[model samples]
Target chain A: MDMRVRLTLAYDGTGYNGWQIQKDGLTIQGELEKALSRICSASIRVHGSGRTDAGVHALGQVAHFDPPPKFLNVPWNRALNAVLPPGIRVLDFARTDRKFHARFSARAKQYSYTLWTQGAFFYPQRRNFVWNTGPLDLEAMQEATTCLTGSHDFNCFMNKGTEITDTIRTVRNILLAPGFTPQETVVWIQADGFLKQMARNIVSALVQVGRKKLSQAELKSIIQGRDRALAPATAPARGLCLEHVTY
Target chain B: MDMRVRLTLAYDGTGYNGWQIQKDGLTIQGELEKALSRICSASIRVHGSGRTDAGVHALGQVAHFDPPPKFLNVPWNRALNAVLPPGIRVLDFARTDRKFHARFSARAKQYSYTLWTQGAFFYPQRRNFVWNTGPLDLEAMQEATTCLTGSHDFNCFMNKGTEITDTIRTVRNILLAPGFTPQETVVWIQADGFLKQMARNIVSALVQVGRKKLSQAELKSIIQGRDRALAPATAPARGLCLEHVTY
Candidate 1:
């Protein structure tokens, strides 16, 4: 019997090259496989709920793997974290039925983009975690997020090389929290799923509107136009974090 | 005529050993001296409010130096930050009175330590910051702080190598904020002066009492006893931040 293990993981993406296997560099998936293999004493394959680009963080990323027979006594949560690096931590673990899959079963994903406006540089210690946009207009950005909320063809908000046949994505919720703090603005978006660079692209457009480079009507037109060329540049991946996953 | 130069600095404290100028590897003072030497075309000495041991951090550390002829109009703040490596930043610049001294003339200082009990090894980025101590009694810790206020002999809290002429310091305040949403605790301390590892050591002792290791009577005895052996070990330096300074 194939035993499916579901793991909720959080990681500082600054050190790894995202949540996928890469032949050339360090990656979250690579590190997990390495730890799982050592603990179970057999080859293992781990799958993630979604792919986060390089420098993007994750607070509640979900993954599942089939445990090898030799490692029957290995506790999925404790054993894995003990061997993993400092930036990666396992929050919770569960034994799942064979029908469950992390990537396939995730019904919705939530991501948050932090914008620190007061200062261009971050707290030296937290510099790697937040995006420093340097004092943006909250009302303008909030108004723009409303236009980005409903279902739409998100081709305009995706990276150019994305290979998905359909670039359509339904943004289930986009709660633009304005003036939450004196020094920071935050945008939280939850969607059925996100295309490559979708959240970042949306953020860039919001930033533009906040800076007065674009109008709300113009932003709505960009979404309606459904042209990749219509959106602003992709915001840096460092600012985005996968906040949670809903099954 | 003597000129006063105010410096707003940032340092990683990971390399070159602490903030003071030592014969060892690299010190923040040594780096600033080098930058000043190049900019001023003459050697200049820098004085910090206080010395931070190796592996400490500062967001708004205040320092003062006398300007040499060549450094004039060099845009010292921007130039120095650009020249400094990724770990240090010079955020602001000011020219002050000739009587100013960073160490002796300083009136007060504020420090904060952050602890999170989440037990997740995966810190979002910049995990090097905020020491992670699993769940502890913050209310107990806050209560313990009241025992430490006012003028007291802090010799018990000083580290082994400290060489201060006096052991008595006035603690203006010690604020204990209960854990925030992420199960994090922040300890903020303000004082007229501090001994070596004083804040860290005080935090250590308080934490022990907070976790039920020592009683409040024991805490009073340790302070009155003025013996270094009576207190808990110094807390990790990584979690402590020199938050503010007053001249």
Candidate 2:
């Protein structure tokens, strides 16, 4: 019996190269594939819902794979995790049909970036997780988000490397709220899909707007300009996390 | 002219061999002194409030040092942090009187330990910060605290090998509260002073009582027994943190 299995994973990406296998360094995909192949005694390709950049964490990244015959009755969540490193965890596992794909079946994706804005000093506790941007103007940032929501051509907010022909994306929602503490600001955005570095660049543009460097009019123009150079530099990957994948 | 300086520090202790400097391994104290020495161009000795074992973290580990002449006018906090590794940070600095001591002048200390007790999967984000002791009985743990609080001889909870013979200490406060998430149990404890590994052992005993391995009466007997061997093993040091030191 060839059963397709889906695994919801959460990883601390601070130490890994990225979600893909690379020749130069360790990666989340490399680690996952290594454990999967070893456990089932067969080659495996772990297909993630989407690739996350280096230092970008994930709370609910979805992936699907077909295991070898030996793994038909195995307790996958426990067996796979037993061989994985402490930085990655298999949070959930279940059988799925071959027609269901981790990437194609996903309806939406939610990403969050944390900014530590109140203190002058960046505490070591949040070093690899949050961006230390002192005193961002939240009210201004919120107002600028109004120009960002809904359907728009997002070429301005994407990295130029990938050949993404269709640059438009529907940004369904965006919210800036007080994080776990008053000192932190959590920027949350949901979209049908994200372009390469799209979330980071959008966040960077908003941060510039919060700093009053880019006015609301300038932000609108940047979106309409359709130029990546017109937007602020993309934010650091350490601050970005894929929070959910809705089906 | 020599100036006495006091510093408040925060560190992620996941990688080092504890707070005190050792002959073989990297430690928080070793990193701090190295940065201090390089910045001031002198061999500086930093005296901390106490020594924390390997894998133990600290949010407000207090220390004081007498700087050489070249460091008299240096902005100690920013200067020391510039050269320190990302794991350690100097949160604050102030000039103190010659009589003020980091260890002897401290009146109280507080420590907090986090335990993950709800889910079968231990999430990677909190791997080094919380103990994964799934599904502890909080009500029973609450009932067990009564026998453990207040002034008592804590020899059973203290790890042997340290020369200090006086095992009596006052546990002024201990509270079990809902953590950031419903799955977590934050154990907050304060004491006038602590014996070596006293906090870790006390928490271990409470956890044992919660699991029904030790009854409340058994916990009381264990403390009264004055035998380190009678108590449960000291909890892992990674979950324990020096939260505050009051002077």
DockQ winner among the candidates? 2
Candidate 1 lDDT at A12 equals: 87
Please provide, for model 2 over B66-167, each residue's C-alpha lDDT reduced to its tens digit, 9 standing for 90 to 100: 987656777888898889998898989998777889999999999988888876666687788889899888899988888878999999988977999888
**Model 2 CAPRI rating:** medium
Superposed on the true interface residues, model 1 gives a C-alpha RMSD in angstroms of: 4.1
lDDT of 1 at B182: 53
Local distance difference test scores for all models: 0.81, 0.88
Candidate 1 residue spans exceeding 4 A from truth: A119-122, A178-182, B12-16, B21-27, B118-126, B178-181
Model 1 interface DockQ: 0.49
Q: lDDT (0-100) at residue B143 of candidate 1?
A: 84
lDDT of 1 by residue, B36-69 (tens): 7776678888999998877778877889898865
